[model samples]
Target: MKKKLKFNRDWCKGCGICVEFCPKNVLELDDELKIYAPRSGDCIFCKMCELRCPDIAIQIIETQEESDEEK
Candidate 1:
């Protein structure tokens, strides 16, 4: 499964709760103190960041990658 992390930068307060809750350390703070995921590929879609975000800033977008076998 292919997944992506979406962040509402406007809602983030830089509390880092989501970062702390991330088991994979996929979330990080940028120079602006906003949340970002430099290691998104390591994410396991655990939704910890989404659930722990106090400001409701994080979301997990799950997508099924189409393989040639699907044709």
Candidate 2:
């Protein structure tokens, strides 16, 4: 499975809760102080950031990269 982190920029308040709680350091704050994922490749899909975000701005998207028949 492949995982992607989605952030709702309008909902995010730049609280940095997600960035501070990420165990893998997968999130960061840009110059605008909005949250962004810089080391997304390092994400472990732990969902810590998503849970900690007060604004519910972060979400984890899971996708199948390969066909079931190919598995």
Candidate 3:
């Protein structure tokens, strides 16, 4: 049940809002001001970044295989 967060550098404005809002400190701003996912494992699946991103550049995807029994 690992979730991954992807960042679109082209849309990022380097506002650092995502970095500031991330409770797990999973995101950081590089010299270019683009937000990068430094520690993705630390992400708590809290859509804080995704919801707060003004540029709408952040996307969180949950990757889990559904059990056939459940299906």
Q: Rate the local accuracy (lDDT) of all candidates.
A: 0.79, 0.80, 0.80
Question: Which window of ten consecutive residues has the lowest lDDT sum in model 2?
Answer: 62-71
Clashes of each: 0, 0, 0
List the candidates ranked by TM-score, beginning with the highest: 2, 1, 3
lDDT of 2 by residue, 2-70 (tens): 677878888989999888888898788888888888787788879999898999988887667542121
Sliding window of 10 residues with minimal summed lDDT for model 1: 62-71
What is the clash tally of candidate 3? Answer: 0
Choose the strongest candidate by TM-score: 2
Where does model 3 exceed 4 Å of error? 64-71
Q: Could you tell me which 10 consecutive residues in candidate 3 have the lowest summed lDDT?
A: 62-71
Candidate 1, lDDT over the whole model: 0.79
- The reply for model 2, stretches above 4 Å from the true place, is 64-71
Taking the tens digit of each residue's C-alpha lDDT, what string does model 3 give over 31-66? Answer: 898988767667787999999999999988655744
Off by over 4 Å in 1: 64-71
